[model samples]
Target: MDPSDEGSSGKRSDGQIPVPAPVMEKKKKMMKTKMVRFTQAQINNCIAYKEEEMPDYDSMPSIIEILSDDLANCPQDYIDELKTIDDSREEDKTFWIKMQNEIRDEREWILRQCFTKGYAEYEVDIDDDDDEDNKVPARVAAPPGRRRFRNGVAVKKNLSLSGGGSVRKI
Candidate 1:
């Protein structure tokens, strides 16, 4: 049977009811929302916000008391472990102090090398035209120590806390 011919069911041969495509089911659209990026500045702002909004420090001792009580409830073995950890930390601290001293000594050696003596000399120009004898009086030479490193690097270090004269270097 042709689709153009009316069917005995009192409808067209096409399965659709021909009612403007049933309004297309309204095409339920998904709502899109923007994704916000979190930055360090924004996090810092949030931390500072509570500083202005939160309560004062009057209850600090009470908070400390509560924390102490909570800690007191912890097992003895855990406290012993904490003490052991602290002792181990002290051992490591001594090692670190030794290493720091070694580094400081190395830096001092480098500074000494940078300011070694006998590495430079100084000269002064003399004119014979002013002397009638064409020979000038022998100029008193600079001290031997001064002449050797006259143009070498010099440094002055000042004491920070105590009131005293500074130490000079050459």
Candidate 2:
């Protein structure tokens, strides 16, 4: 048989038989790394959506959605804890900026991952808090009330020293 035709015979005369193409599988689809800005409502919906059903990714999926499912897979409070996170905390930490301290929590750490993957963005911008943040008014400090007097300099109006006395001045 012709040397070229020998290959067609399905026999290896050279003692070197290559594996069949059927055994080799196609490459897996890599998760989309593109960081898209999602509104806070959408993100919250995503969190809630995952509770009942899996999120269906389109032909392309954002990192947030994919990571949300991945991180949400475990028992965690990504949403409730996210609310308490201060804006400055997210703003100050970024890939571009070198950090003196480690990340604070899982949520922020996960969001900032976009930067390490080459997406330059902030956690706040990604959340798109244009409306969600506005709904809740900014926290204001309460008026300072009476001061504590360890030295007893300020006298009390109705201070009771002994149990028998109805009222006593300190």
Candidate 3:
């Protein structure tokens, strides 16, 4: 075969068989992360609902939808915050990014507390005869050396009951 005819014969000019094109890997869609904010009133309402009904895991999506609808009808405080962040993005990109991340984290934590942990805080006593007293609020007992706060925040301390050297005199 004519060496110049390699192009027509599907062969490389170097007398080697041509290899097919490498399979193109599919590109994955990148998820856009958006920050969501909640007002104090909305948060209170969600907490109240959680405490009153205490829906199970299956109802979490419905609870989230309710909160979203409430937010839609409420004032635009969250939108204002988003605008502020957007405005500052031109001046300081790093600070804006950090603030955005902090806002996202805080929003996630609030949702988790209101939806997941909130339901878990109330224990359902199925066998108890007293219906009014059956719904007991759960409490996390702290470890021997730990102290739990009223809001459920815990802190570890080297406390000595014998009035020993736990506290150092500076």
Local distance difference test values of all predictions, in order:
0.49, 0.45, 0.53
* Tens-digit lDDT string for candidate 2 (59-157): 334344456756566545675454345333434445323332232243345445534653333333233443454587768886698556455354435
> What TM-score does candidate 1 reach?
0.25
lDDT (tens digit, per residue) of candidate 1 on 1-170: 55445444545435644323244455434444443433446434433442122233333333334456576878878767666654565566576667767756654544444347412222344444344446668898776654454355554545677655554555
**Candidate 1 total steric clashes:** 0
Q: What lDDT is reached at residue 66 by model 2? A: 57
Residue 33 error for model 3, in Å? 33
Candidate 3: 10-residue stretch with minimal lDDT: 50-59
lDDT of 3 by residue, 99-145 (tens): 66776665556768667644222223343334444667889885796
lDDT at 165 for candidate 3? Answer: 41
Regions of model 3 farther than 4 Å from truth = 1-91, 119-170
Best by TM-score: 1
Better of 1 and 2 by TM-score: 1
* True lDDT of residue 44, candidate 3: 70
* Cα RMSD to the true fold for all candidates: 35.2, 29.1, 24.0
TM-score, model 2 to reference: 0.16
